[model samples]
Target: MTAEQKGARLANLWDKTLAAGMSEPERLIYRSNLLGSDKRITNYGGGNTSAKVMEKDPLSGQAVEVMWVKGSGGDVGTIKRDGFATLYMGKLNALKSIYRGVEFEDEMVDYLPHCTFNLNPRAASIDTPLHAYVPKKHVDHMHPDAIIAIAASKNSKELTQEIFGGEIGWLPWKRPGYELGLWLEKFCLENPGARGVVLESHGLFTWGDTAEESYLTTIEIINAAIGWFEKKITGPVFGGDKYRPLPADERRKVAGALMPVIRGMISAAEAKVGHFDDSDAVLEFVSSNTLEPLAALGTSCPDHFLRTKIRPLVVDFDPTNPDVAGTIAGLDKAVADYREGYKAYYERCRHDISPAMRDPNAVVYLVPGVGMITFAKDKATARISGEFYVNAINVMRGSSSVSTYMGLPEQEAFDIEYWLLEEAKLQRMPKPKSLAGKVALITGGAGGIGRATAERFLREGACVVLADIDAGALEAASADFSKRYGSDQVRSALINVTSEEAVADGFANSATEFGGLDILVSNAGLASSASITETTLALWDKNIDILAKGYFLVSREAFRIFETQKIGGNIVFVASKNGLAASPNAAAYCTGKAAEIHLARCLALEGAEKGIRVNTVNPDAVLRGSKIWTGEWKEQRAAAYKMSTDDLEEHYRSRSMLKLSVFPEDIAEGIYFFASEQSAKSTGNILNVDAGNAQAFTR
Candidate 1:
């Protein structure tokens, strides 16, 4: 087919995608075809697409529905309905109302629990609210090759002005998802009739009342930019016309040396599912240019920075030099310099946030004589690196003729790739604890503390079973966690901690789901407050029956079955509180907390014989926004503490030596330490995260 015919066919497919009143699965299939049809539109999983579906609300007798957004790490070209996280629209809208006029990211994390979608296999898109805010039936966002070429141009604004005229709106590059979504939200509210949005230093977002308009707008915008570049510039003619393929023996050697590093970055499962593309596109780009000029070009877009660092390693080896040691040392120095630069960038952006993993040689770009090889732990990551370098080369070539290309500034690029919003996207998914290949059961997994602990364990790389009595909350939390983490990493079971049979069944379910349990977080509990005189038997019985008895039952099962049977060392953490030792107005709560602490101590002593380490985290007020501190609870706590709601929060923070509020994340860190190798020699400990709230002399 002719080029124009191919473009038209892709456009027609997009039209069909929007026009057809198909089910969610069918729409995903069509969307994938349209995006895949044009190499310029999307490569592999570079973009995201979503559709809103109507379903009955189990809570209210209403026909409320959700938008099934594409999950993380899933390719848009092949994503299915199961891959789309079902974010309840009503819940999202409600959250927006509660946190009215606040930033969308804050709203998302706060209201994440209300959404009824499972968290595994699917996750709400990082751009979930952006798609939701468009007021369109369907939304399409992509990193189109043609658009990136134009955006990466020296005269990008001028080029866009000439091609799109006044139809396109340009947004200065901000971190995507939350900040970008907010900016787009305001821009859309103002313009109301914009054709599409061109995110400078990022990508394009196009939408319409119908999916076809959104898709066509994306196509037209890209075509216009491509046409302008073609008209304005001419391609360079190379003198070397002879095409020579590398020798078969040498090619095999090159591939063999690189395969191990590549395989480590991604999964064997993903490698089998998708075709690896370490082809001429990547090799040609690496060998075409001088190392220095190529490094100066930056990434294709800021998003690509996560997969492929800002640039690659310039492998200039002199095999004939005879001093092999000197050559290897020189290469090592180059890599060390790259790592130093990365560290400087991190330090500059640091604000009490923990540091991310640093990969010194994300990509290795060899010279003309030497073959190129990209390094990633897996094929998926390696392919991402390969694709990014290929795109960057194209941009560099296109811009060199016209003018120097300026990419995202260092800070802006850092923010895009490492922003909390993006990190939250990865965290939303469930995984095994740091104790990978081990089994864990998190009680009260539906609650704030329990959920935080569960997410932390999953990230550390362990399979988790989240058990809770609140079935609705459990389902919603599980759905949200699974979307980013994957369904296999976590499972949800409904169990009332007060019932022995239910607790037993929950453990059985966990063992069946994850092979066997090795860690137990006895996190299930209540938090009702009442004066000693006001506290009744009912409240006392309720708190003790669950918090105290629940801890004993869960720990007992782990010691007998999981730890002893596997003959592996195990860990048990009780989510006790600072209030357990300190005085509190809530009589029942204080009694339960104190008993829970004693139970942890007893269990720790008993489990020592079975090679299980039991511990507890005495957390101070974890005041981050969530349902626990919503509305009256927040206001009342603030009032009783003799400060404005906001100021009252500062008091809790001031009590800590770090002057930072004790976040659920801080408690999770403590949990991780106990479960990690660093704490292997230690056991029967109580980690206090109250920020020095309890002085020894005070009691």
Candidate 2:
């Protein structure tokens, strides 16, 4: 059978499955499995689906209804009945009445007491109310690649209009959950017959009276948009002549140098929000492009601004000059220009409504030949923004064939970029307020440790700057965080910690970017294990440079500046390991960690006089799914120990006195305490959050 026939058969099967009079629980199970099975429909935990089930309450004579929405932390495709949070529809509607125009996080917290659930379940979807507001009995949302591919295009509005016509109502991107629900509620009331709501820079939301109807409508709408986009943006095959390969060594060097900056930028975006998207296509596109202007195209979607800023750093590398200082200076000037232009756009767009602050939430990096690096906090966000740029580039290139694809006017783009309502939604999130006025810089922020630490700082109210060495990962991570936190509270930078000049420049840039730094988490480091006999000088130097010297350089520069000028007693938390105090089989790895701990101790003594507190958190075998314990290293350790991977993991956990695997989040909490006023009298202290493994002092 043809592909179309196969799809039709699947659709028919889905319809029959739901029509079998399955209970709500069984229906949800089938629906989730169907959605999860298709990557083209949803990614790992990417999309959400919900069904409004009406049931009679035991106590009351009147019938009670609850929205069985998808719970947090579960993949839509594999979600079960328990994954749905059963919320009283009346309570949610009542919340709308009491908190009309009020902040969302506040509403969520205020209504938490009224929600009758296991309470231990992850928080409800940010799009809960939006789903509840849909008049249909079932609702579905997805980051379908084909749909978003069209949405990311510059002419998405036009394309959407052509395909969906009056059936779709478009809503500009807003932080999801309550605000999105409110906007969706208002739109539904206004456009009575609207089949679906298309969130610009976000994803599609469709609903229907039946489960199959909702699912089918979603697929149909997305397919329509994809068809329209493909027909309009066709291109001929250009292979051999178009492909250019760089020398392997040069490519590696360029990739290494570019990684941290891109990662940092991405991490910063996520620190504010809570999530980002890291699609495979995004990573391939950014890494493959080796041109100047083409690389400068900003994020694939607006949500990416939450990860990688709006644009990338434009690098003009001149082989003849090879002046690092000159190249950096030029980049700085370009950023300044972009910021000024952004401000001008905001000013022009401002009306009687509240205006956005002067700071540009995102940055565009222009790296000549190596393409552009779009950095954010989390992979998801960076991916979305990167996808937006990919689509924009397609439009720009495709438009050259047709009429030029006209982008939103500068003022219009600025209006949405700096929308006060969107900003307000972020300000109202439910998070701790300890780091409110402080600025923090987190390195290696896209990884598990970096992401957790950044989240901790953001929770305590710190305006965080997350930096990392993996540009793609950083952008994806930063985007995720920025969506949860306000964009203003977080910014990402791309910087290499090993380079003294780069470190200094990054710090200075951060100081200017966030006003001044108050908390510095020098959390970026690496671990490489080699038996003493097999250790090479090159490997030793690389490990020491990244883990030991890198910490020294970042702390030295940040401490002096914070002491000399700011006079604001800053907090510096270096992520060390139990390996610093205990002997590990890997000599170079242990030495580098030991050196980092000593450096922290010395900095603590020196910074104490300036009222700055420097401390370190020693975490051992934290097993938080980081790169250190993945791939070859994990396999090697398991083999050497003569145990299965699961056994090895269990052994590590059992070694901890508390019998709990040390989590990056646990270490992040320790960092938070040291950075916040809670540890006001604490300085130069080494806190071991290794679950008592350190007390035993065993390797």
TM-score of 2: 0.50
What would the per-residue lDDT of candidate 1 be over residues 84-142, giving only the tens digit for each residue? Answer: 67777767666655554544455565455467454434546567777777666677888
- In candidate 1, position 558 carries an lDDT of 67
Model 2, stretches more than 4 Å misplaced?
A: 1-22, 25-52, 57-60, 63-136, 141-145, 148-209, 220-252, 255-313, 317-326, 351-368, 371-421, 430-699
**What's the lDDT for all of these models?**
0.62, 0.62
Candidate 2 lDDT at 563 equals 51
| Tens-place lDDT digits, model 2, residues 160-253 | 6767888987876565656677788888889889888777655688888877787778777766754554565444311111223334434334
The stretch of ten residues in a row with the least summed lDDT in candidate 1 is: 266-275
Q: What's model 1's lDDT at 417?
A: 63
Show the lowest summed lDDT stretch of 10 residues, model 2. 1-10
What is candidate 1's TM-score against the reference?
A: 0.53
lDDT of 1 at 609: 68
lDDT of 2: 0.62
